[model samples]
Target: MNANNIVDATTRSPARVDEVLDRFFSLSTTRAATLAPAYEALWKTLRSNTNGGKRFRPRMVMTAYEGLGGEDLAAAAHVGASFELLHTALIVHDDVIDRDFVRRGIPNVSGSYRDIAHTAGLSIPTAEHRGMSVAVIAGDLALTGAFRLMGLAETNSATRARLLNILDDAVFASAAGELIDVDFSLYSGVPSVEEIVDMERLKTAVYSFEAPLQAGAVLAGAPESVISALGKFGREIGIAYQIVDDLLGVFGDEHATGKTTIGDIREGKRTTLIAYASTRPEWSAISHLVGKSSLTPAEAQIVRTELEACGAKDFTERLAGEHADRAVAALADGNVPQRLVDELTPIVAAVLERVR
Candidate 1:
């Protein structure tokens, strides 16, 4: 299929998934009438935060389901929505950890609360505390909502248990990875490429890719071999996704991405591209570009140029292609249905080619 067709398919998948999420959000209000005011605030915050995401995780779930020959689109969509809710929980907590104030062009949960506190004439430190408190509670609410949605999804007991197991494991692993990431940022020594990849896999790959695919496969009653094959495929794609994101942090259009360019460099994130560049002998220019309090647009451009010259961008792109090839090969070798392969092949291609 062409790129446009792939976009259309992916678009359709998210719309279906969002519809399910909307249903769940509406149902969440049934108890709002009887709940305490604080509980009502928590639920509303969770729902609002969950609604603003791009639904990438949910798309992954639905794509895997369709690829595995599952015809129950509604059930798949509901499962995808559950994943989205889980992802929202992760993001809300992650933003708190990162002390980020914005996401997708709006004040993040914490930032919104901070704004309200500031409007009420609170001291700056007190406002910050109020924001963080609300964010922490909102994150917990989102996490609980994720499990509730999963339990309410239509599926067999066996499938439900399997999916839950995968989801639970991914959540735990992701939390550990996030801790490692935060610790790494605070330390001085840089880790090896293998260690960096391990961090990426644990913090990102499994939950971002493998678990979603596995959940869909379980729902579809896919064979063990097929599920395993998809797992490998998802891991590779997930890593590439992170690499692309890292690249965008330095070079992408800020308007398109809804994030400040070079924020990763400012935050001192130890990404694969950074790891690779730092190991090279001619990395002085690149090294100086990162780990700064702020970066000027001209400086960011120069850093982007240096990154390209050092072959970091090319290397990342090549790695993404390698993973995409592996994903496609797995589908072919595992005898997965052709229609699913056709749907995913272009999606993988687009992911590798994405600029923002």
Candidate 2:
């Protein structure tokens, strides 16, 4: 399929996307209001954190629904909104774990709470502790809200149960992957590329792509074979998405990406690019640059250059393409409606091509 066809097929109506967001925030606000004022402060933090994301997970859910011959836009919107809620919950907790200060050009949940406390004249360490505490509870609330939304969706009980199961399992698997990621970070030992790929699949793929697609398909009353096929497709695209994200972390424009260029290296993330570069003797200088946080911009550039020189970037890009191809192929195998397949082709392509 051509790009325009793909764009038109998968591109959600702006009004529909807005409706999903409105429903989500309205639910979030109502649920949050029942809490104490301090907890409400955390709710506001959650709201801010979730406000400006690209809505990628929700969009994926809706696209999959459309791909499955689902014509009920309202139903698709509910499924999409559920995924977005779950995603926001995950992000709130993730930022706390990563101690990430910034997200989408704004202070993250924990950071925003910290700033609020600081402005109130709390001491630095005290403010940080309070903020993190609130963020943790707020994240829990968001997670609960995700389940509530799913329960309230206008779908049959069987479909609801299946989607909820998938969401729960994906969350557990993603958490396990995050733990492994933390373990890898703390240890000095380098993991093999194969190992890194495994980590990426669990940490990023299943939750970000597979679960959302499966849930959408289930909601559409798709056959089991079709749902399974979409899951396989989602796994491939999701992994590619992470690989591309890793590439962008090192090589993308900081202003657009809202991240420091090469921040992953400074943070010592064990991504596919790092794994590939470590295999090349010619890239030893780049290897030396990997774990150092004090690297100058020039040094960062040199390291990125070395990564390209060692063919890491090219290899990663090719890997993404292979996954995209696999996703397209899976679509063909599922006996999916032609219209749905047509929409998905470009979305898979866009996932591979996204700069941020």
The lDDT per prediction is 0.76, 0.76
Candidate 2 lDDT by residue in tens digits, 252-295: 76665566776788887888888788788856677777879897
Stretches of candidate 1 off by over 4 Å are 1-12
Residue pairs with backbone overlap in model 2: none
Q: What's the C-alpha lDDT at position 32 in model 1?
A: 73
What's the number of clashes in each of the models?
Answer: 0, 0
For model 2, what is the C-alpha lDDT against the true structure? 0.76
lDDT per residue, candidate 1, 2-25, as tens digits? Answer: 123235446344888888888877
- What is the TM-score of candidate 2? 0.91
Q: TM-score of the candidate numbered 1?
A: 0.91
